[model samples]
Target: MKRVVALAALAAALANSARADSATSQDLSKGYAKFSEQGGQALYANVCQACHMADGKGAAGAGRYPSLVADPKLEVSGYAVALVVNGQGAMPPVGRMMDDAQVAAVVNYVRTHFGNRFTDAVTKDDVKAARP
Candidate 1:
């Protein structure tokens, strides 16, 4: 009877852990949608800050987040839109969590800010079309 009770307790603990993980993931995803109207800064903080870092310099380790500052990829608005919408490598697909306008705002902000001088402006239509 003790063995059976111990097994049940272990199973319960595992289930709770899984639930917590799922909730954390959902909260992170929701952060992308938070303050969609507030434009790039808010969106970046809520969604990208965890991985890309607040400075946009990204991290250097086993899996790099790729610095957004002065990145050649930002030279093309479409490229940035596609990356945000479809994601790449270790990056998760965040387009679905954000509306087209939000995507455009964040993409444009990233391209223009972070020591970047890219003049191209990403439109909502561009983000919508880039969705995979």
Candidate 2:
């Protein structure tokens, strides 16, 4: 159907965009390229914003993407870190395509933004430990 085709196209585009964004930071050991985005805001804008929405309120249609806005789950930084590193349910393990620092940056951005006010940061060591 048209919806299926459109979804497929969107997935392909996102995959391609990720690849391009991480082209310069290939991690041969992991067999995946690391995202080149350095800042938390940039990483969020380039990656997480798509599904979670620009407002971090998430979306609902074909699937249920949980809202990051003032979500209590983000209060525990480890939960967010592990989820990013390992994923859960419908969410893909996007952290696999990112380095520890990138993962930390993105997670920190999400926690600090979207009306969520968890001040404690997710360090690179936290992300490294969270990785499978």
Candidate 3:
């Protein structure tokens, strides 16, 4: 009886440990996916190029379009979703970019691919939190 109890306890402990590990793995995967840079690039080309132009190089004359790619602030601790959703200076607010998930995807794309080494990917929650 004593041996049986000990074996049962050991099995239960192992099962609990495996469950905890599975949960941890899932959490990590979700966290990593939030920063998919390719998705961010797609968002940029489709939505941002009209103003900023290709390669994130803003127009010279009138300079109406602000540079979107390869920004110094790309390496900043916070996600750029706030500024993307909210207009700054002459940039207009995001109306079509209202889709939070799409915005995060695009932001991650730009931040990762545009000559910037930043690996951080924005999440839908991040965009939602900073939404105006």
Candidate 4:
């Protein structure tokens, strides 16, 4: 009887730990959903690939193509959203082609898919705030 009770207790503890871990992961992102990530990927495919290349290596010498992945403030969607909207160097202002939601999606995509540390996904409001 003692052994059975001990085993049950251990199992309960393990289950609780697993649930806590899941909650922690979702909470870490502050309610950012996986669906938003997909939107971000679509935006990147549509708007960014031409010059920066699909992998974001960019071209040599000319530097007309900027590195969209792992760039200045790449880990933060807010900073990236600002640059995408305002434009910099050779990058044309993307706000002309995309709205706030689209901008957030792209920024979130690059920041997350490129292995950067943007924990929470970007939102339309984030893009609006980043606007110059």
Question: Which model is ahead, 1 or 4, in terms of TM-score?
Answer: 1
lDDT of 2 at 54: 91
Give the top-scoring candidate (TM-score): 2
Candidate 3, 41: how far from true, in Å?
A: 3.2
- Global CA lDDT of candidate 2, please? 0.85
Worst 10 residues of 1 by lDDT: 28-37
Question: Candidate 2, 80: how far from true, in Å?
Answer: 0.4
For candidate 3, lDDT tens digit of each residue in 17-103? 865786756522222223222355555765677677678766767555656566888776244776677767777665233477877
lDDT of 2 by residue, 66-106 (tens): 89999998899999999888889978888988889989999
Q: Candidate 4: list runs displaced more than 4 Å.
A: 1-38, 69-72
Residue 35 in model 3: shift from native, Å? 20
Candidate 1 Cα RMSD after full superposition onto the native fold (Å): 10.6
lDDT per model, in order?
0.79, 0.85, 0.64, 0.68
Report the C-alpha displacement of residue 39, candidate 4, in angstroms: 1.9
Q: Which pairs of residues have clashing backbones in candidate 4? A: 40-105
**1 versus 2: better lDDT goes to:** 2
How high a TM-score does candidate 1 get? 0.70
Deviation from native of the Cα of residue 24 in model 4, angstroms: 42
Q: If the candidates were sorted by their lDDT against the true structure, best first, what order would they fall in?
A: 2, 1, 4, 3
TM-score of 4: 0.62
Q: Global lDDT for candidate 1?
A: 0.79
